[model samples]
Every structure is written in structure tokens, then in C-alpha cells.
Target: MMRIRHDQRSNEIPTPAVSFQPESVQMAVMKEKLTDQEAVVAIGQQDVRVRFVDGVPSDRSFMVRLVKQEGGTWVAQAVPLSSIGRFVPASLDDGIDLWLSARGIRLTEKEKEAVRRFWETEGGSIKQKQETVAALTAKQLEVTETHLRLAHEALHGPPLGDLLAPLLTKTEEPEETDEAKGVPVREQTERWEGSRAYAAASELVLPPAETRTFVMTAVTEKMRQLVHDFRVWQRDMARQLEQFSHAVAQQATERATPLVESLIHSLDRMLLNGDWLLFTDMKTETKLLEAGAKLAEAKRGLAEGKMDEAAKTVREVKALLESLRFQPSEQKVMRFFLESDERQGMKPHEQLSRILKQASQAARDNALSARGVVESLRRLGFFHEQEAARALLSGERLPPAENVKAMLLSWVEEGTAPAQAERVLMNLTGQQLLNKFTADSHTQTMLYQWPLSLHGEMATVHVHVNARSGNGQLDWQNCRLYFLLDTNQGKVGISLQAIERQLSVTVETESEKLAAVLQSYASTVKDHLEQIGYRVQRLVFQPMDTEDEERAATDRIKTENETSQWEWTI
Candidate 1:
């Protein structure tokens, strides 16, 4: 029920006149430019609904004025809420301006004003609220302007009276003489109704030569009646449909039937006649298994001679379970009671179903699951030690080489083969590497963490890193600088870069040959990371062993890594 006013006198003001031609205003500037969308141009009285990109998945709702900038691009500047106006009710942007105006708000200047208002909120915690609001408001304004322009065009004739100007100008309403002014408005509307577009379109079908005043009058009356009847009938049918739908919904609820029941019923037919292979759903499977387990439990109790109790429980459970829509299982457990003697019958449990006979088959299932584990272990190669342990203790299978190597290393450390149960605990190692590393970009520069796991002289890095902090003394041990290799080379340290679980290198070798050797080793390491699908964004060099330099590296590692040369923003 929005009514936009252009001037003081308002007579249920209709659509706004829209024009792209400049009329003291750059009409083109009134147009909106959608960054990734096509512009929608409209004119007068039409409502514009423009969705501003909030960059958030869910956007808050509001209405604002659509204004085009000098560049013919729309910008959302929240207008004073008091200066807002209403749009037509049915329109998308209809009532938007009015709503804003009613609230004494202006959409065109929304970003600037909204930020000011929101900052008053207690503990808001939004640092760049103004910037975010500006971005969103700008996007909304563009869309709003486009819609407003389109609406304007629909009502007013191109505002410049351009294109089709003659027809609009030529058409004029009949003059009301003094005596005719006394007639009711409806009577006047009816008298001239034939002059409307529908009457003209109908007249074109008649034979000009056969046309007469009487015949024309008769035809016009019939046409009016027909249009009236159609409208009335349409209204009645609409009312009936709405009532019937509501009643049907109410009846369904009273009968305690679920909408899913209908869907489930349709599924059987759909499966037989349409696609069935694609019907798998985890939720449906879980429901089916649940129902089956309940049924099995009921049957087990019945077998134990609790007939009455089992019957009541099973009946309620079955009906409740069946009420839910479910995907049928490939196989279902069915228990058949056996008649032991003429005097009595044994229950399902006494007869023993497959699930109940599980103890007799536990060994088989366990073996199958074990085989699956081995296949995966074989593919990974790191589980070989476990496999060998299993074989030695239980005569299962051979272990992989990597697994055996880890086990051997563990045994050397402990100086003895740990107990079966303790072996699993002793081998546990955190992320291991021994080199310079970087932290996540979101972290502060004061502190950073690196993840690493090392055994002997080998460092398995899983991330990219950078090093800085020129020269200073460093306590390598406290800093987790383990797995160091000192061969004629000064010192080679490895560590995991915290951002990505990848290896980093810091070589302190004063020997040129050793440096070259370390670089060669790094090339191999890089290749390994690439093979494992890790992002090798950067590889850097910096001085370690110096206390000040080392401490500096530790403190600013995160920022240094993020700004490193080898790092790509993407």
C-alpha cells in the first residue's frame, strides 16, 4: 500500500515516471551497474528490488533508494530514514523507500549512517565496521537504482517524452461538462470502458462493412459481461482451493499420518520404474538397521518364554518403526521358532538365528576385518611393523619395511623389545622434523609454534618455512632442535612449519661441500612433499645457532613466513 509523492498534491499517486534521458539530472546516472550482473532498467511507479552483496551468506533485510552515480553505476548511500518513501506493495522494491522514510532513514547513505548507529552497541567488537557497511551499502544501492529506474520507465513515458511521445501526447481524457460532472465516477468509467485497449483489440476482428451501431453496442455489452464473469469465477475458484487445501492438511494431521509416509509410498514405485541405484542414503540405512535390531530383541525375549510381554512390546515397536520411511536392507534377519515337542514350542533364541550364533562366527568376521586392515597397511607401508608384530605373536602376516624400520628404531632406544601392550605406547611420536619453520599468517609475531617428530638423524618435514633473525646464540635443545646431523658440515637443523604440516630446512654448515649436499638432500625432500601432494610454497635460508638471531626467528617466524618470497597468496 505504498504511495510515492513527487509533489504536494497526492491522488493515490501511481507509478513513478522513469527516464534514462537527462532532465536537469543525468538520467543515465540514475541507472545501476551490477559488478557481476546485468543492469535492469525500469521506469515510473515500478518497484525495484536490488539485492546488495553483503559478502556474508545470510544478509540482513531493508529498503533504500536506488541512486546512480556520475559513472552511471549504482551506489547505496543510506538516505535519512525520515526522507524515505514507500513503493507499491506487490513490488520487490515496493514500500522499501517508504519503510526507510517512515523510520526516518535514508538508504543512499546507509553505510555511513548505519556504522555510526551500530558503534553504540555494547561490546560490538567490530573493528572495521564502517568499511564493511560501506561495501555492502554500495552493492545494495546499485541494485536498488536499477530497479527504481525500471519502475520509473513503466509509469512515465521515457520522461523526455522521447520514443512513442506522439501517442502519449495525442491521447486525452474526455472533457466533463458542467451537467456531466454530476454523474458518478463508476458510471463515467463504464461509459468510456469500450474505448479501452480490450475493446479496440476486439473491434479489429469485425468486418468493417457489416459493422453497425446496434451490432457494435451488442458486441460491447457481451464482451464486458464475459470479462466480468471470468474475473468473478477466478476469485471464487481461488477461495475454494485455499479452503480445500487447508482442510486436507488438517485432516491428515488428525489421522496421525505423516508426509513422509506419502513420500515413502512413492519411493517403491519410483524405484521400480525409475532410477534405483542412486537411492542409497545413510540416514535411511541407519533407520532400517535400528528397526531390525528392535525386532531381533523382541524375538529373543519371546523365545525366552515371555509371550505376553514380548507381544505387547513388539507390537508397539513394530508399528512405530514402520511409521518411519526407510530404505530396505539387502538382507533381513528372520527368526523362526521351532516346535520341540507336542507339548511345547521353543522360542527364536532357543532355535538360534545367525546373529545369535555370532560367537561361532566372530573369528571369521574378525579375520576378514583384519585382512582389510592388512591391505590398507600394505598400501601405506608404514604399518609393516604392526603386521610383523602380529605375525610373530599370532602367526598372521609379514610387516612392511617402513614399519619394521620404525620398530627397530624403537627397540634400539628402549634397549629391549617392549611388552606387546607397551610396544604400541612407546612408538607414539608427534609431528617430527628439525628445521626453521613458519607460523600461520593469522598469528601474532611475538610467539609461534612448529610441529615436528624426529628419529635419529632423519627429519621428516611436512611444511614450508623461512628463517631470519641474522645472528645470535640459541638453545637448540629447549627449542626442540633435535635430529641434528653434524658431519664435517657445521649443523643442519630441521623443523615442521606450523601453518602446513611440512618440513623446513636450516643448514648451518660452514663447509661449501656440505651446504651443497644439504641442498641436494632438500631437493629430494621437496620431491617427496610434491609426491605426497603438499604445497611447497617457500624454501628459505637464515642464520641459526646465534642466540639473538635464533630468538628473533622464534618470535617473528609467523610474520616472516607469511611475507616470504616463496609464498604465494593463493
Candidate 2:
């Protein structure tokens, strides 16, 4: 519908014959070192459907002339839109010259006058517009140029057109002449009826009514039946094409459904068996779970004949899978984590789950009172501290220690955990961790603090419990753990704080050596915690500010040992 005219003749006048070789002009330019003022005109002229306002499509032709500026970058200005129709559309090289000369672009007086004479000879008006009719801004021109380049690339190859020249050249169809229209049936019949042989045959023919009745009842009915059959066949083919389009749209989902289902089932099994934390904050697992849910939605949409929705959902799933941050080595580790049975007996949360169940029942005997519930939360809090420290000591494989360590440290420092695990598994720390942290009553608060040891390292855990509510169910609202780890070089101050029920870790020490050790081992600790369903925040390392470093270390260790008491104080 958007037509580009070569001349200002409206639709009535026939176009003039004009030709320009773009290749010839380009070759000539390549042979010479062109000056800045003597610009080789590059035109991005086209009639396109552009959205000018409110995303409404408008048909407009643009003639942009790009000139090389001081630094070799091209800057463009819009030529009068009417200039596009002044020259032949296929004559791109001539059109560029015409546009430049019309605007008096970088031309000598003699050259400009010669171009003006040629324009006049071609019936072009010398009365140019004071300004470009619909000029685009520089940014808009850049976008237009990019679109033009892409369009050129799509239409023509990067090669010198030699490879596709035959295809590119216009192959004009044969024009239908009036003689080729063929003789009409009425004319042919009239000639036959006027012939002497036709007159002799007419004399032996039946009356007009009898002849008409025979043809209508027999030949005409037969022809009508054939036409109806052909129409039915055409309708059947159209229905098949519609069905085919739906099939194509749904094909990807159909192919991926089995694989996706298998992976989901595998993940479910892994979580159920307590293979909890492969990495701190099972984000990869969570994404896969979400993808599975979306895949289900897509299936439903497809089954209900919502092809567009199904296609869109499938694309989203593809993108998510592609965007997974796993490296090749990490991918292998993930596969091992999913498929290997190495952690069968070492289910990360097995011990924690058993201990919580016992604590829960013991607390329930007292009608789920705040004191009893706080005790359970206290035990759970201390467990994570011990586990994190233990993992640090073991130097466990965490999907690349530094990244995981960094993630955990950020979580710790920012106190921001990723999206909460949906339906935190009741069997593991899910129900226990979320349920046990709360406020002790409205006014009077209940707090639980305890110390834990990991291979001679000392740590303290603090749990703030909410008292019995009107429903009689108690919850722990906040918890924190402070711990220290001794490395070969010095002492590292490691603290894990779980505020608002989210766990985070921090490290502090006077010695840079000890900080490095903690920094290296932090990811291992995070990995272990994550495996155990502990979403740990990032790590924070701060230097001990004391002047007497040895004394400071002694004081820190003594303070931790002094506070290593299993006491429940209100």
C-alpha cells in the first residue's frame, strides 16, 4: 500500500526511463581520496511504514543524504521528500546526486549550475522547499540508516553482487497483448452459427425449448455437481491448513514436555530425599521448578487451542534455560548432584529434621508454649552455625567457591535473601525454620542465646522468639549467629546473622591472613548451608581495630568461651 513514486506525475502519468549504476559510482569513489567538502553522497531513501505518533503506522517516503564529517563519521540531513519522486527509484546513484545538487550540497558554482540544467531538462522544478518537509532528527536518522542497512543485507548479500547478480536483476514478466486475450465464446459461436455448415446443421436440429430442456436437465446439472465437489475439496484443504498452523505452534512444547517432566520429577525426588543444599539458595532448582509450572500452563493453553499463549510460554522457558549461569564444569556438577546417589545416607537435613521433630513434640506437650518453641528454634539456629563452620573446615566443593561465597556474603551484608522458597519443605528445615522464629507476646519478648563449637572454633547464636499468640501457636521472628574460625595465619571473625528469619554470615579479624582464609572458605560454608536449606546472606569481613592485636584475639576467644552457655533467659 505504501508506494514510492519516481516522478511527480501522480498515478496517471507513466514513469520516465532513467538509469544509474550504483556500482560504477562506488568504484569511482574507491579510486580517489575524496576530501571532506567533496562528499560521496550516500542515500538511504525508501518509502516505509513508520510509526510517527502513538504507534500508529503512517506511509512516508524519506530521502536522507549522508555526508562524511570531520572524523569520518557520517551525518545525515533529510532532503525534501518531494525530491524522491524527481528521479527514477531504481537509479539510486543519480537520485543521490539529484538530492545533493538540489540542496546545493558541497558543489562548485559550475558543477551546481550543470546539475541544475540537467534537473530542468528532466522536468524537475528549480523551486525547492525552504526546508525538508518531514525531517528526522539525528537519532532518528541513525535508526533509519540502521534499518536501511539491515534491509539491504536481507535483500542483497555482502558480496559484490556477483554471486546473486542473476537473482537480483529484475526478471520482467512477459506482457499480455490484446491478441493473446483469446477469442470470446460468443464471437466464436456467432461465427459458427453464421457458417453454411452451421445453417445446414440447424435445419436438422430440434426446436429451441426441447434443446434447452435437454441441456439444462443433463449437461448443466452434471457441471453444477462437479463445481460443488471442487468447492468441498477446497474447504477441506483450508481446514487442514488451519490445523497445520496449530500443530506447528504446539510442536516445541510437545517435544520438550517429556524432558521437562523428567527433570522436574528428578528435582522433586532430590528434595524429598533431603539432598537439600547443593549450593546456598537453590536458585537453579527453583527456576527449573518455575519453568515446569509454566510448561504446564503452556500445555493447558495449547490443549485449549490458545496457540499464541502456548508459543509465548514456550519461548520464555527456552530463554530461561539459555540464561542459566552454569559453566560447563558447574553444569557437570549439577548433573552429578541431580543423578548421583552419593549423598544417599548423608541427606543434609536428616539430622536437623530428626532433632526438630523431637523438639516440636516436646514443646507440644506444653500446648506449644513460647518457652518450649523458643527452645526448638534455639537448637535449629545453633545447628546451622555448627554446620557452616564444619563445611568451612572441610573445604567442600561448592559450585566454584568464590562466586558462592560472594553470593552468601552479599546476602549476609545486604540481609536480602532471594525469593523465599515456595512451600518450604516441612520435612527439612522449612517448617521448622519458618515456624520457630517469632515474637514472644505483644509486649514482653522472649530471647534465646546459645554457643556452639566446631573443632575448637567458638560461635554464639541468638534467637528472638515471639510468645504465644491468641491461636496458641508460637513462632520465632528473628535469629542470629556469631562465630569465629582460626586459620593457619590468624583468627577470622565469622558471624552468621538470621534477621527477619533470613540467615546471613559475616567475618571479622585483625589479621589479613585470617581474612583471606575465611574469604576462601566462605563459599564452602555457604554451599553447605544452602544444601541444608539455609539461605545465607553475603559475608562481611571487618578488621579488628584494637592496637594490641594479640590481646584482642585473647579477649575475643575468652568472650566467646565465657558465653558458651546453654541458657534460656527472658
Candidate 3:
């Protein structure tokens, strides 16, 4: 594998833009912490360039060959995909495919089909086809009437137009259209029920007159085979129609879904860059969504004519999509169940079926059963304490839980939930949660509201720090910290509530002079938690954000003046 290397460090300079394009994907070499001029120069100069933009995997040997064709301008064209980059040219097949898609190329029939179906189901209005069909039907009727009138005129004395007037008139036929509705709703329902019963009886319920048979032409085996094949055909048709809104319209439904997923993911990456990226990506998102709507409309157009497949497919996707909204950290979400036995071990992908498992049922019963709860415990990154807590919670018939509490606590104390799953096998029966007591891997304490009276003698300080190591690594111990302030104090609660908006503080700490100049900076925060009235549940300092280096660069330039404040209040 060829690697892109520079004698100068990227961090010492600037970062490069990793992007996609058509025909020839461009590779750039950039400095990480570069001066503005260096950054500009790196970008301006084709520091490093890799061509052949299409990234999709295929058997085809599509490639791009670049040439400085006599003139100063270097031209690029598609050629067989080959090695590129560094001392030894390395083929970045992944990037190649991505570049292709970025440039609107695709490989793999499944990928193509997926992209097509997604778009069609997701596309725009499909009603025009139905309207066309109706108009055609009306035209045929008019033609038939005209022919009949001409025949009558030839046979008799009346004018052809006059003879055809009855058929040609646009009068509403109440008898033909509303006959079904004339019957009472109940009577109509019963009539359908009776017809269905009779039809069904002809096949299954009706008695067979073997002795009184007049003529037998069809074979019973062939008829049975026909019925079986017809059923399979119906099922397939229904499945296809359900997938596409227009069951009859071909090719249109095939183009939608991939476009949506691809566009959405790309837009997400763009948003990470900055407001400019956001603005750009949002437009792309809107375009992809609109295209998808159009494709869906096309499918819908075909599936009309009393076919319910399209409707079913739409409904099914609609339901499944609801699940997409909540991105849970663990697969064993309370909302869904796992397929694996709760008593046994399970792999992530192999664990459970969200739809087939009894998760919803257990949820209602407050008995969340996943594959041993061990995986979720590991996911939570609770060290040993949380895992120990979960081990008891899992309700396996291990030794008496009261006695085994120590065993679980040992795991939590070590932050070894993943390891715990492997090392010890405690029967489920004995281990359980004692309502009052719980285990913790690490402990933290908060101090708030120190007295002004004890200025130098016993000055109090409030601080947060993680001092416990579950992995037996001292470095890991310092990765977390928090407070356990004034649980019994009244003013602390009020401060906790209001301070969350913004902490206002004035402090004077000595610099060179032990009693002199300290720094006090005023700051504020936007909404962190709107669920007011709840007591400060350990301010879980868990903030989730995706990494966008480009966006960070832009932000750094923007907030150059925002400096940290020094406060005696921890």
C-alpha cells in the first residue's frame, strides 16, 4: 500500500480537504496547523492530486490517465483503475467508489436497485398516469358510440349524429355508477360477504359430486398446482407493488432510495464544516428529497387500479421509519427486544430481531430482557460499578443475589464490564438489586458555598475531578470528574437551578503579590436542560458532538476573543 507522506508535519502546517468528484478524484496534501498563507499556498498548488473519481465497486476496469498534453494545462481522462499515491501507488478503492458516487456514478446492481427503489417510493406525484388511463377509456367509449350510430344511420333514416346522441351525451348514469350505493350500507356489506362465501364454497366449502359428474376435463393435480403458482405470483406482485407505489410503472421506482441516503449522508458531512457548509448541504438535501418524492409519485402512478400493494409498502416503510428517529447507544433498547436468549451470550449483529422479539412486551411489563444485559452494560462504559449494577438487574438465577452482590460490585469497581462478561459466570437466581444499596466503580464529591469568614485559615473550594481508575490504569482514573455539593443545604439547590443558565462570579486572586490581582470572567450558556424542577441529578457531563475539523477551524477564527475565566468557585 502506497502512503502519502510529507517531510513536514501536517500538524505543523494545515489540513487538506478530503472530498469527492467525478472522473478523477483529487488527492490533496495539506499542513495541519498552517499559517493562513501556507494554507492558501498548499491549496493553490496541486500539492497532491489523485484522479479517477468514481468510487463504486465493479468488474469494469474504469480508470483515469492524466497527461500534461504538450500545453501547460494538465488534462485528465478516465482509464482503467490503477495504483496511485506516494512512493508505491496505492489503490484507494473505497475512495475511488466514493468519488464516483460523489460524481453521480454507481456500481453493483443491488446498489443501483436500492438507489432506484428509494427514489421512486420517495418521489413526487404519480397521479397523471391514472388520469391518462381514464381519458383513454373515455375516448374509446366515444369511438364505439360513433361507430354504432353510423351503423344505425346506414340501416335506418335518422341522421348519424342524432342516432348516436344517446351514447354521446354527458348525462350522469345513476343506475350504472351508484347501483352498489343504492343498497343500504349493511345490505351492501352482507351482499359482498355472501358473494365471497359462495366463491369460497365453489373451491372448498361446496360438496363434490364424484358419482354424478357429467364431464371431467381438468386434472385435480394441475388445478392444485395452478392455485399454488397463482398464490406465489400474487404474493410476489404484492411485494413488488408494495415496494413501489406504481405497481404497473416499470423503471421509475428503481431510481430513488440510494439518492436519498447518499445525499443525506453527504449533507451531514458538509454541515460539520461550518455555516457555509450547512447552507450548501441543506440545498442538496432539499434537492435529493424532492427527487425522491418524484420517484415515489411515479411508482404510485403504476400501483393504482384497485391494487393495494403500494399503499401497504408505504405504510410499512412509514412504520419502520419511526424506529429510525431514536438512535440508541445500545442495541438492547427498552423499546425493542433481542432474539438471543437473555440467559446466554450474544454477538451484536446476531443478537435479536427488533420486530420479532418480545422486547415490546417485556417493556410493557418493565422486564427489559436483552442478551444478558452485558452488551448494553459495556456500551454504557460504566466501568465495573454500572456493569455490576446491571448484572444484578439482569435477573439470572445466579447464587443468592444478596450474597453475590459483592461479586458484581467487584466488576463495577474495576470498570471491567466487558471483562466481567467473560470471567465470571454467576447463576442468575442469587444476584439482584437491593433497593437502598447500589455499587459504584468510582466516587466523586462536590463542595459548594465556602464561608467568607474562613478566608485563609480554612478556605473551601468546589472542584470536579475523576480520581478512580477501573481499568487499573492511573491515567484512566483522571478521565472523569464532578461535584457532590451541598446535598443537605438549601441555597445550593437554588444556585444549581439558576447557575445552570450562566454563572456570574467576581474573584480577586493574587498573582506576583500573594494578595493581589486575580481574574474574573463573566459567562453565560444557552438551554442545557429545559426539564426544570428535577433536582440536580449528577450533572452527567456527557455531551455528544460529531468531529468536524473544518468547522472547528472556522469556529477558532470566530471566537478568538472568548478566553477562559478564573474563578475560586470550582
Candidate 4:
């Protein structure tokens, strides 16, 4: 519970009057004051004047409770710093007990412990903590009430109403009418007919044989359209150059014409040779876009009669295009996807390692965000389409689906580029395929996979949960959770199994050096799990042998019944 104080003796303090606005808590920084009792404080983005009911704190900052008054004024009450530490309990279980007890609901010791352990191993964050707490509290209340009722019945026997009920005259059963019986039969027939019609309709809609082939063909067509747009833009630029002075036109042509021609030639060769995948690197796409923007700037300068500016802009454009002449290779594209940007001040391995650690914690703490990622990709695709449409309407050409698709694939695979509609659609289709395969397997395993972008690099995380199900409800108490992380530093896997509130964890990696690094943090991980209230039965860091990689891959595909032991190996 929270306490608020109102001091009538302090005239400087605003009276605590009720307002329509809800109460809120915020942190505030105390500033130097005009008087002993009056001082200014920074609360969020606003500077507020507050009068202390008690003496003002000597400390620089503290948490404050703010309440709105009827006159639209805010009254601030400083929370004692000492009391703030008590907000989070020393143990998660203790916290759960306290909350339940506060609600006038009491549970047996075993029941209380069970509730506490559920909170520890559950997959949720602070954002959903209260909801989980409320649900658990309600469950305990129901269980306790049931026990009490059972005890009452055992001691007192059946109720007086139950004894009197049997003494009353029996009521005659009513026979079902023909219409009632026919109604159900008719409904059953209609349902069967409707389902049959739906099945027929579904069979008529033939899906693509190979989604990859469909995607490749669509991308190739988009690339061709982009090339056509580029040619039109080139002709428009040539025409615009004529508007400039003769000297400026000659200088611009000398600088820009060769570079533009070279770029178009490269694109033409790639499109004709069916080697667009070689050009999927986001850096190359960005350079190409930058070159276009410079050309547009040059055109604007020429139109404004700034011949010197236009010539300089053309020179910049020439330099940018010259940088794009490097030979594209599979290795180079993979490197582009894996490498972190130098400007971000972190190596690829370091950035990925950090992301992996955060991901491990998030796997236990947060709800899976795979669906959110798909939604984001959809939104981004729509945005890119709108941008392209606007550009077309304005007679300014934006690069076509080739560049957009390249960017989107880069984003999906490496989390480096923007999302495009084609890639989003392709991913959505892939998701459907994944669902089909998973359903066909008839397994009680839940899987979620998503890409995480950090410090200009991307890491993919895959989570698998195996649990028991009865009465169509999953039993999380006896469940196994596996997290697989793929990053520049290599793959790291974590496996957690919880049974009756006891948790065992195994962390595995292929590289011995990486395993050694994670070894130092093993205890920290265990402590964190324990802090959440579950007993840490075992925590192990086992590095896999390089030679065993093939064997490990074979073991992973074994059916649940065939695989006697679950191993977390990367």
C-alpha cells in the first residue's frame, strides 16, 4: 500500500483536492530553493514548484507521487527514499505471499509455494506481471473456498435442502416433440453440406508449387521495371542538363554521364545474366540510392541557375558511382550481412554477444514477438509502396521492386535493410508452410523464431517449448524450454527444464573460447533464476566438440519418443 500526507500547517503546500485525472507516480529531481520549504523540481519534462510537508531532501533526486487538484494544479508528495527499497520484495515468493495476504485470501503453505514457483518459471515480463498475479490469486481463492466447503460438508453432512428435496413429489418427464428432434437433424445436415462446399472451394484454389520460384520470378520482373524507370530518369536528367549554361552542361556531362552509363550497364548485365541475387547486399543498394539522390540534387541546382553547385553535385555523384564498381560475390554478400558498421563503435561479435545475452533473458521474461515481427514487416512494406507511388506521382523516379526487395530480404535475413512488400508477402507465405509442417508433425512443441537487430547487426533467435497437455490445456510445470541463438559469434543454445518448481539449465556453444566467456556469467544466470523464486537444481555450461557437429545435427531430428535425452547443443 502507498501512503499520502497532507499538511494543513504549510500554507505554501497546495490542498489535496480531488480531480478528474487519475493519480500517477513519477521520479523527480530536487533543485535549489527560493525558501526553506519551497523548492523547484524537475518531474519528467516539466519544472514544478513543490512545498515539502516534511523537510526537503538533501539528495538530488527521489520518486514522487503526483495527484491532480480540481483547479488543474498538481500536488506532489515525496516518497521516503527508505520506503522505495521495500517496493520490490527481497524474494519473489515472499512478494507473492504478501500480495495474496493483502487481498484477504490465505492459502496453505504448499499452495502458496506452488503459486510462487509458477510466477518464477512463467514466460512473462513486468508488463504482464500484475495480470499473472491476479490470475494466480483468483485460482488460490477458488481452491481455498472449495476446500472449506468440502470440510463443512464432511462435518455437517448434506444440507437441509438436500434432505427436503428427496421428500418432494417427482416431476414427470416431458417427451421431445417431433419438430425438436427434426430441427437438430436438419442442422447437422446443413453443417455437413456447408463443410463439403467449403472443402470443394478450397480444392479449386491451387497454391504455388514452389514459393521460392514464384518469389524469384516476381523479383526479376520488378527488377526489369526498375531498369526501365532508371532509363527514363536518365533521359529526363539529360534533358534537364540542357537548361543549364553551356559551360555548366559540359562539366556536368563530363562528370555524370560516364558514371550513370556505367551503373546502367552493370544493372543491365545483372538482369540479363539472371544474377540479381549477387546484388542483394544492402550497402550496394544504399550507395545506389545515394547516387540517385545526388543526381536529383544536381538537377535541382541546375533548375535554380546554380551552375557551380550543380557541377559540384555531379562530381559527388560521379565519386559515389565510381565506388560501386567492385565485383559482387557470395562471400562478400554474406560478409555484408554479418559485419557490424564501423561507425557503431562495436565489432560484429561483441554486438551479437550482447544481443544473445539479452535474448536469453527475454526468452524467459517476455512473450514471443514472432507475430509482431511479421506485422512490422507488413507495415514497412505498405510504407515503401506508398513512397514509391508518391515518387511516381511527383515525376521523380524511385528505384523499383528490385532494390526494394533486396533491401527487404537483407532486413529479414540480416536485419540490416528496410522491409519491402514482396519480401513481407514471401515471409507470410513461408509462415503458412511452417504452420503446415508443424501441424503435420502432431507434436506438443511450440516454436517461435525471429530476427533481432542490434548495433547494425542481426541475430536470429529460435525458441522451442515442449510441454504436456491434458484436457486441451498445457501443463507448464513439467515443461522444457530451448533457446537457440545464431549470431556472428556463432550459435549459442540454452535449455531450461522446470518440473514441480525446480529448474535445471544447460548452456552450450561450439567454440571453447565462447564457452569460457559464458562460464563467468553462469552464476549470475543461476542467481537471476533463483531470485525469481524457483530452485535452481542444476546449471551447466557444456561446449560441444567440433567433430560431433554432424552427429548432433542427426540427433536433433529424432522423434520425441525415440530421443531418450534432450540435449541443447550448437
TM-score of 2: 0.19
Cα shift from native, residue 404, model 2 (Å): 30
Q: What is the Cα root-mean-square deviation between model 3 and the actual structure?
A: 35.2
User: Please, what are the lDDT tens digits per residue for candidate 4 over residues 332-417?
Assistant: 22222222121135533333333333332222212123222333333223235545677899999685332222344544577553
The regions of model 2 sitting more than 4 angstroms off are 1-436, 439-482, 486-490, 495-506, 519-540, 545-570
Question: Of the candidates shown, which would achieve the greatest lDDT relative to the real structure?
Answer: 4
Best by TM-score: 4
TM-score of each: 0.18, 0.19, 0.15, 0.26
Off by more than 4 A, model 3: 1-23, 30-360, 369-570
> Looking at model 4, which ten-residue stretch has the lowest summed lDDT?
555-564
Per-residue lDDT of model 3, residues 408-521, tens digit only: 444456764333232122211101110111124342221111111121121112222223333222221123222111221210111121221222222222221321211111
What RMSD does each model have against the real structure? 41.5, 40.2, 35.2, 26.3
lDDT of 1 by residue, 1-570 (tens): 999768666557665555432211111112443433333333234433232233111212233344443464333333333333322233323333333334344454543333334434312223233222322332233323322222222221121112211212222323545653443322212322322312332322223433434444553454445345434533443343333234334543322222222323333223222221112233333343333334344444444645444445445444544444322111110000111121123332222221112211222212212222233223222344445676899975553233322443555577664233122222121111111122322211111121111221211111222323212322111122222333334644444342322334344433455555556666666655444324445554433445423433322222233232222121
Q: Distance from true position, residue 422, model 1, in Å?
A: 13
Q: How close is candidate 4 to the true structure, as a TM-score?
A: 0.26
Ranking by TM-score: 4, 2, 1, 3
Q: Which segments of model 1 are wrong by more than 4 Å?
A: 1-483, 496-513, 520-532, 546-570
